[model samples]
Structure formats: structure tokens, C-alpha cells
Target: MAIVKLSTTERRRLSVFFTCLGLAIVAWIFTTLSSPLPFIINEALVYKNSPQKKAFHPLQADTIKITIQGTGWQMLFSKMKPDSKPITVDLTPLESRNYVVLSSQLKLINAKRDANQQITAIDPDTLYFDFTNRLTKKVPVRALLGIDYQKQFAISGNVSIKPAYVTVSGPADRLQKIDEWKTDSIKASNVNESIATRINLQPVTEGNLTIYPKSVQVNIPVDEFTEKTLDIPVKLINNHNYDNVKVFPQKVKVTFTTSLSRYKDMSDDLFEATADLDLWRDHGYSTLPVQLTRFPPFCKIVKVSPANIDFIIKK
Candidate 1:
């Protein structure tokens, strides 16, 4: 193979191109390092497992605050693992201080390891958080059912809770009046059938108190009524044995009212009236003797003005 060398002019041109490229790379590096990106605190980070030995309550500011550093676009799209993690702080440590003290320490979140040990990097390694010890107090649990109905109806059953109480933990101002909690009124008219509804736990005074059971299950009994009319049949006593004997006013006038609840099981043939045939047989002998028949169930024979009537015997 034969080798050829470039001319002096060609070498100089290549040198100039390389110098410009090197300068551009330096400028890019400087710009990237000098500029700071915007970020947001998405959650709190807890460094030690024993930040607070006691259980932590919800909505209570504790051992950590999660600070995320990134461009607006990246922060908006980024998310934290285990979306919700309990951050604890030791209240005993801050007991000496008159006011609550916040710790300046922070922890970085790392990628979780699987059965196969491997190093994984989680984005936004370091996180900043604010910590304050919260006071816990007992509060009454109020049952709430979020339902609205028309008027003329009411709800029944378990208006008061069985274990009608709960515990709350938060700022001192909010925990002062943590004895009771009331829920919004549940409309009765809206109730058609039994229902289970959710209600928010609101503080009587605007404070940072966190309820143990944030929500409660309310059991409401709905009342329903229907209107109906029943037609009861007017019956005649001794109807079969009447043979030649006639009844003046065949139907015994009966007009009464009953409730719709029991009306369905009732029939019209439940009422009847009859004449005393013993009077006729006493006067003279004839066919078999007859008396008033039995009445139907749940029925009354209304106003038999002339209950007894004379029956003429046919020779």
C-alpha cells in the first residue's frame, strides 16, 4: 500500500475546524452547569425507621417533606414510588422545646431491590422535608349518610353509632375541641330503600385535626307507604237454605275502610247478614231450620238495621 500526506493548506483547514468544535463543546458544558432548574416538594422523606416509635396519624405533619428537583416538565410528569408513605417524628425529642421543632435532616429514595441483587438508580435522589411533632386526642365519631329525599318521609335505625367515638391527632389549636364531630344532615325524603353512604370528617373549629376514620359508613332505613282501596263483598246468612224464603234488601249495606298494608290478603266475600229462621219454625213446622252463618276472617258485619226479619212459610 502507498501512503500520501495532506498539503499544508489542507492541514491548516482541518486544524481550524477542530478548534471551533472544541470551543463549542466548552460553551455547552458551562451553560448546562450554570443554569438551575425549577422543582417542587412532592412528598416527605424519612431517614430512620424509628423517627417516631409511636404510630403516626393521617393529615398530620410528621418527620419529612419530599422536595423534588427537576425542570417543570420533568417534575410534572415524575411520580414517587409507594405514592403514600408514613413519615414519623419523635415527640419526646422535642419535649424540652416550648414550641415544636422541625428537623433539617433529609433522606434520598432509591430504587427497590428484587431477589437478584442489582444497583438501580431512582430519579431525584435527594428529597427535602419539614417535620413537626403532632398531639393526639380522642374525638367522637359521627355517623353520616349522604342522601337527599323528598319530604314526608323519615330515616330510622342506628341514628347513634355503636362505638360512637374516634381519635384525632394534629396541631394543638385544632385538637382543643376534639371531643365531638358532627356530619351533614341526610335528607329523609330521598330515601326509598336502605342505603350506605360516605361522609367527610369536618372539625367543629377550623383546625388541623386528623380523624382516625376519615369516613364512616351510615346505615339509613327508608320508609315507604302505598295507598290502596279494598272492596269487601256483602254476604247473606243462610244463603243456601233460603229455598223459597226471600230476603228483603239482599245485601247488607257495609262501608268501611282498611289499611293498604293488609288490604291485599282480604276478599269481598268476608261480610254477611241473615234473618232468624227460628221465629218462622216456632210459628209453624216446615223444612229444616237455619241460622246466621259464620263471618269471614278480619271482617265486621256493619249496621244490620233490621237484623231479624219474618219469613213466611209456604204450605
Candidate 2:
């Protein structure tokens, strides 16, 4: 094809038209992508892969105000949120604080965001971590448990926790006074059956503290109790005038309850029933209260038949 050259005025007019067309395209793009939209993501910052020798503290809790831009449809339907996991911020880049800029970690933060969304600005643009030497300590674990059984039910044995101690590693000063860590509240109500469950260790507010065993298994022994009766002789003591007074009944029935495991261990020999003569009256016959001086361990005294014994005064 042969080229036909136009005059300078015609060419100028054509160049102007092309320039206007180019400006129109650029204006369309600027309107579509340049206007910043504010999207505030709250409580979404996470730290990972920090230096093993150094510990970081007071992780930033401020909201991430990401001023982003996208096509109208992209901004309308697709939510633009940032995840900080992929962001690798070297806190000890130069073994000094000056290396990382104080004003903005956005470049480090931007690496974590979705690629399609364009970020124009971020608010509170600076975050600096306070670093300290990592610390490790072995602390004991205490359980926090409460139980209320149904009527006539009780615990058979002590509550037991597996792995009574845990390793807590964090900043030295923070872990220095923490001799023990307690588990979260494990409350069971109206519980007649035995309890066996895994309990989580209560976390401390200290930053960068790691627990070796985050949880432990707790076992509680429970069983329905049984009661038994035994005739125990009442021993009289501390009587000023024993020859002048007499107790009518020589023995009383003592009823007690114990766990099945300890049922066979209880006997009248393990208990001592007694009556005091201090409250005696000069009347022919009077009632005196019977008191237990001793009883078997872990056995509950339910009843003492004939709580009051009749005594006839001879003098």
C-alpha cells in the first residue's frame, strides 16, 4: 500500500484527537483504581518465625486501616482483608532497632495481603517490637475444679491430674515469679458419675510464653456411698462422783457411711462413743447426750442411735 502524507494542520488535528483519546483512557483508569477505599481490619495481626534467641512483647492490637483500590465490581463483591502470616518481618535484621523503619511496616505487611487488591495507604503506619532474650522455666501445674454431687452421693477418692508440671518458656523476668500455672475452671454440677476429661492450661498475659504440654487429663473418682451400723459401748469419763451416778444404757448404735473401697475397713473398734457427767441433774433419771471421741478416716458419721442416754442417779 502507498502512503499519503497529510499537511501539518491535518496531522496536528489528528495528534490532538489521539492525545484526547489517550487522556480519556488514562482518566478512566484513574477514576477506576486511584480512589482509595478504607477497610479497617481489627485484631488481625499475628507474629511468626522470630529469632529463637530473642522474644517479642505486647503484640500490636491496633486495627489495620488498609486504604485499597479496585474496580467497582471487585470492591463490591470481593472483600479485601489482609493476613500477616506470609509477612516476614525481621526484628533482628541488623541486631539493632534502627534497621527497621519506625514509620511504616506496610511493605512487610503488604506481602501478606491478597495480590489483586491495590493498597494505597495504611493508618497508624508504624509498629516496632520490643525484643528481649528468650527464657525457659519449668513450672508446676495446679488444677481448678469444683464438683457438686446429687443428693446422697460423694467423691470416693482424691482428684488426680496427669503431668502435674509443665515447661513455660518466655521472657526471663515475666516467668521468674510464676511458680505454677493453673488450669481453666472445670465445674461440674449434679454429677453422680465419674469425670474424666482433658483440661486446658490457663494462659498468662505474658507475651511469647510457650507451654510444652498445653493440656492435661484429669480423672475424678466418684461412687455411691453405703451406710452401716455398729454397736459401740459408751465410755463415761470426767465424772467427779462416779460412785454416785450411773448411765442406764451401756452401749449405743453408731451408723456411718464410707466408700465401697473403705467399707470393710470401718468397725466399732475404730470409734469411741462417750457420755459426760457434767450435765447431770439430781433427779431420778435424766438424759445425757452421747458424743463421739474418734471415728475412722474418710468415714462420715450419719447417726448415733439414742443420741441421748438415760442415767439414774443413786445418790
Which candidate number maximizes TM-score? 2
- How do the residues 67-115 of candidate 2 rate in per-residue lDDT, one tens digit apiece? 5555554554445533433223444442455234323556656565677
**Model 2: pairs clashing at backbone N, Cα or C within 3 Å:** none
161 Cα displacement, candidate 2 (Å): 1.5
Q: Where does candidate 1 stray beyond 4 Å?
A: 1-72, 75-105, 108-138, 150-153, 156-158, 169-173, 182-190, 196-217, 225-315
Q: Assess every candidate by TM-score.
A: 0.33, 0.52
**Clashing residue pairs for model 1:** 43-66, 44-65, 44-66, 65-129, 148-190, 149-189, 149-190, 150-189, 150-190, 233-268
- RMSD of each predicted structure: 20.2, 14.1
What's model 1's lDDT at 126? 31
